[model samples]
Target chain A: DAGVTQSPTHLIKTRGQHVTLRCSPISGHKSVSWYQQVLGQGPQFIFQYYEKEERGRGNFPDRFSARQFPNYSSELNVNALLLGDSALYLCASSLRLGGSSYNEQFFGPGTRLTVL
Target chain B: LAKTTQPISMDSYEGQEVNITCSHNNIATNDYITWYQQFPSQGPRFIIQGYKTKVTNEVASLFIPADRKSSTLSLPRVSLSDTAVYYCLVGEPLPNSGGYQKVTFGTGTKLQVIP
Candidate 1:
């Protein structure tokens, strides 16, 4: 089966502009999560959606938002972008939202956003 | 969330066993320990995970002692292809279990495998 897939591998936008990144999760997966990774740093969680509902959100600002579709695909949107927002946005998929077992998270190649 | 601390970098020769240890002094009873490997310009790949004791997969082994304050990831006969950043994450897998559960990654250990 195909793994998680993301769109627009590279993006360049001016400051204060808006951008949207898309992701399609693996088949049969129901949870999709978004993460941001800056250069030389580990990824930071942004938002997590399970079964088309927002399950958890990170410490990001209101400018960042995300929604999950019924098919388990997700889109991350950032408005009024800042130079600090320039980073690799990663999408991860899991089986469910809550449980004791820690299922492995499958990740996408990510969309590199460059804010000029 | 438990804060994890790991070595910043490590060097190993080909066909050598590599072990990376992470210290999480305040890990909760329900938190799970997970390890991820990330190559440059790519997303992180889950290597292995364990709650306590020992768990082994085809690729690596995770050894968590009874104290649960620390964990070790063991890679046997590693090669140059194994060079990557290894992250140790300590968090509860459940959503909204305690306020909001977010996975916090440390600086990670950058493993350089020389051929």
Candidate 2:
């Protein structure tokens, strides 16, 4: 089976612009999470959706939002992109989420978003 | 979530057993330990996880002592291909700390295996 898949392998946006990144979870998976990875830092959590409901949110700004579809696919939107937003946007999927050992997330190759 | 501290980098030769330890001095009672491995331009892959004692998988072994103050990830007979970044993560955020749970990752330890 294919792992989590993301779209637009690379994206370029200018400051003050908006960008939307997409993700498709693996079959039978019900959870999708979004993360932002800086060049030299670890991925920071942005949002998590389970069964098309917002399950968790990170310490990101209000400009960052996400939603899940009935098909379990997800989209992460960043409004008024700032220069500090340039990083690899990663999407992960799992069977479910509630912490513990059951939350092993399978990640995607990531969508490299570059804000100029 | 508990904070983790690991060596910035480590170097080992082929066919050698490598053990990387992580320190989480402020761990909580319900927190579990997890490990992840990642290569350049790729997403992180789960290595092993353990609550206490020793847990071994086909890839590596995770050893958590009784106190749970720290943990060690041991890779047996590691080769050059095993070179990558290893991340030690504690459990999700506490209940009172908001419901924004996530797989928190720190600046992982970079392992360079020499052939």
Candidate 3:
């Protein structure tokens, strides 16, 4: 089975522009989560969706939003982007929403976003 | 949420064992200790996880004391390929409302293995 998959492996956008990144979770997985990793730093959680419902949110601003679809795919959108928004956006998938099985999040290669 | 603290970096030679310790003084009862390995330009890969005592897997071992304030990840037989950043995260297994564990990652410990 494939691991989590992300789209637009790399992206470049101007400040104040909008960007949307996509993710397809592993087959049979029902939970998708988004994270941002700045250079030389570990990833920070953005949002998480389970069964098409928002379950958790990070410290990100209102400009950042994400949603999951019926098939368990997810999209992360960032509006009014700033240079500080440039980072690697990662998508992780788990089998379900709770317990130890869900704690081990399998991540995708990530979409590298560059806001200039 | 529990906050994690780890060393900024570590240096080791091939064929040696490496132990990276993480401190989570504020961890809660429902939180679990997890370790992840990340290479440059790549997403993190799960290494090991444990709530207490010791848990060993093919890739690494997780050691947790009774107090649960700290945990250690031990990598055996280091190699140049093992050079990467290791992250320790503490969070509940259940999602809050957004469907995730509300995880917070620290700066991580960068391990460099010499040949």
lDDT of 1 at A77: 96
Question: Of models 1 and 3, which has the larger DockQ?
Answer: 3
DockQ of each: 0.58, 0.56, 0.60
Report the error of model 1 at residue B113, Å. 0.6
Docking level for model 2: medium
Q: Which stretches of candidate 2 lie over 4 Å from their true place?
A: A99-102, B93-100
Taken in order, the candidates have interface RMSDs of 2.4, 3.0, 2.6
Ranking by DockQ: 3, 1, 2
Write model 2 residue lDDT over B1-115, tens digit each, in one string. Answer: 5899999999999999999999998887877899999888787888888889999999899999899999999999999899999999987743653343577889999999998
If scored against the real structure, what TM-score would every candidate get?
0.96, 0.94, 0.96
Tens digits of per-residue lDDT, candidate 3, A44-89, equal: 9999898998988888999999998999999999999999999999
Per-residue lDDT of model 1, residues A1-116, tens digit only: 99999999999999999999999999998889899999999999999888888878888999999999878899999999999999999999987666666667899999999999
Please identify model 1 stretches exceeding 4 Å from their true place: B93-101
Residue A40 local lDDT, model 3: 93
lDDT digits (tens) for residues B12-103 of candidate 3: 99999999999999988778888999999999998888889999999999999999999999999999999999999987646344336676
Q: Which scores greater on TM-score, model 1 or model 2? A: 1
Q: Least accurate stretch of 10 residues (summed lDDT) in model 3 chain B?
A: B92-101
